[model samples]
Target: MLGALNMGAFFALVYVAAQLLRTSVAATIMAVSPVAMMLIAWPLLAERPKPLPLAGAGLGLVGVVLLVASGSGGVNPLGVAASAAAMGLSAFGHVLTKRWGATAHVLSVTSWQLVAGGLVLLVAAVLVEGAPPRVGLPAVLGFGYVSVVATALAFSVWFTGLRHLDAGTVGLLGLLNPVTGVLLGTAVAGEVLTGRQLVGLALVLAGVLLGQPALTRRWAARRAARVAEVSPGSADHPGSSTVDSRVPVE
Candidate 1:
């Protein structure tokens, strides 16, 4: 279950997001994942939210509404449900990883989850889809790329990043994954980026940026400064970058 949630979330979300919202819009939606993680962790892990991250989450909500409402198309129920499921599962998986392997090596965690998830998925596929897929060169290439680059390298880099930076910082950086997807879809798939989509995408990015540690700190410091200013005799503390953001589990 955990493994399925971890690996399957990425594949399922990407496909559905691309189909429902186009590649770029889908990527923008994914940029809001950190916000989702924070929310999920709140109820599950007793986490709290920082002001900037909350603002970013709000921005994500707006962006989602605008993007879905743009043009003749409103929100597609199936698409929204699939995307939400993908994100929710991803968030749950992350929390479980943190809880299950608080002291375990990231590689070990990755390996165990991948194996369990693969087996579960394979069994599910055999039961529902009814047959193994024909292995072709293109399929092989796709599998190789996802396994080597997306899975292995991504987790390695992520675990390393967790060592140095805060979760908000690392999470913000992870948004680059969706950005690459959006760009590639535009260049390779010839997907059109409409005016409304551009605007919605902008909102999504702005939200993600707001949720980053640096920006969140900037906002926090500014608020603190303002509070100090308004008060008669308060200590001045500039460059205090602590927000109420949740720390990543090791």
Candidate 2:
């Protein structure tokens, strides 16, 4: 089931949507997956969504919307539906993986999921598209890169992250997908970055930074220090020496 949701169905639906929708549009739709994952993880993994990360996710989502709004074309209903399903399934699968709690090695778990999903995708392809078409050397190389670098290596790191990070934090990091896409278009495709896109990029970066565990912890610590300083019996308080202790001291 994990394999089906994350690997097979998610990839299949994404391909289907990509055929009918613009890349920016599809990517923007997929950007909501982090929020979905956070919600799913709340109940399934008993991981409560922290306020800072939730706020950052909201900010990042807004940034993604701005990044795509200019380039998004007319929406195809089927494509939109497919994209939404892919997002939901992937989020569910990710949260489920987290819920399972890293019982096995990350590589071992990733490999098994890939193999199971690959088999299902292979059978489906044979049925729907008949025999595989012959491809040039370039195409074979591209496939090799995707299989090795994109799927195998990428998923290994992703699962490792899930084991160590809060689901909400991991989800917020996924906002980078669309950010990378937009930046790649500017750099690789020679597309000009508009002012709105620049602002969106900044917001997305800010959001990612805010959701980082270290930053969140620092902010929490600062807030706690402030509270302690203002409290009557705190050491930093001027009147603290006047306050009597409730418990007997040695």
Candidate 3:
């Protein structure tokens, strides 16, 4: 619940700040979330990646660099400050989620966060945004899509996976968001993807593929088998335990 609420708060903060400034600047700031997640994961989650995920993160960094570089224009001080705050807050929340682990109930956490965030947005709409002007058809449609499909549906799929997976693996999957967003935005919004951006995207995808926990797990098993074969009775030894050490204790 803390994780979800923190993410929601971060999003809400960014969205509100965007409204108060330029959309591009706010987006750039939000892009920092992935990088922040990786940094936090290293210390807080003790995420020791073996080449692949780190490479993927590095690739993703290229994409992010391209994103920021491509958007270099009139800088708004207020926008910069707000975006930094949003990024920092979201990153901290991500670390907290990893620290808490997947034992936490996903639905309850998501729901509480949504409810809390929605309430916060409601208050902001009323007080800060000054009643939030009456929505036209387009705005109504946008809001509906954001609330229903983007927020509800995306989170449902994400939370389901999170419950069954390591936080680091889940975090790696986030690399997809930027890639998909860049490609889809280019296609749907008629934005052009430059050659540099394409290269960056490829690197980012490579990193994601490399860092997949499934691959690492498979490799680890293979290594363990080799070790057991070499050591003979190592697994049957009294002190040197297997991966199921927790089972006998529990």
Task: Give the top-scoring candidate (lDDT).
Answer: 2
lDDT of 2 by residue, 1-250 (tens): 8889889998999999999888777877887887898899888988877778888888888898888775435789999999999999999999888777479888888988899889889999999999999999999999999999999999988989999998888888888888888889888999999899888888888888888899888988999989988898886678787645776777
Local distance difference test, each candidate = 0.65, 0.86, 0.66
**Prediction 3 global C-alpha lDDT:** 0.66
Model 2 regions more than 4 Å off: 71-73, 225-250
Ranking by lDDT: 2, 3, 1
For candidate 2, give the lDDT.
0.86
Put down candidate 3 lDDT per residue, 17-86, tens digits, no spaces.
Answer: 8767655455545655555666776777776545555566666666655653554457767767767887
Per-prediction TM-score to the true structure, in the order listed: 0.69, 0.88, 0.71
- Return the clash pairs for model 1, or none: none
Best by TM-score: 2
Counting clashing residue pairs in each candidate, in order, gives 0, 0, 2
- Report lDDT (Cα) of residue 12, candidate 2: 95
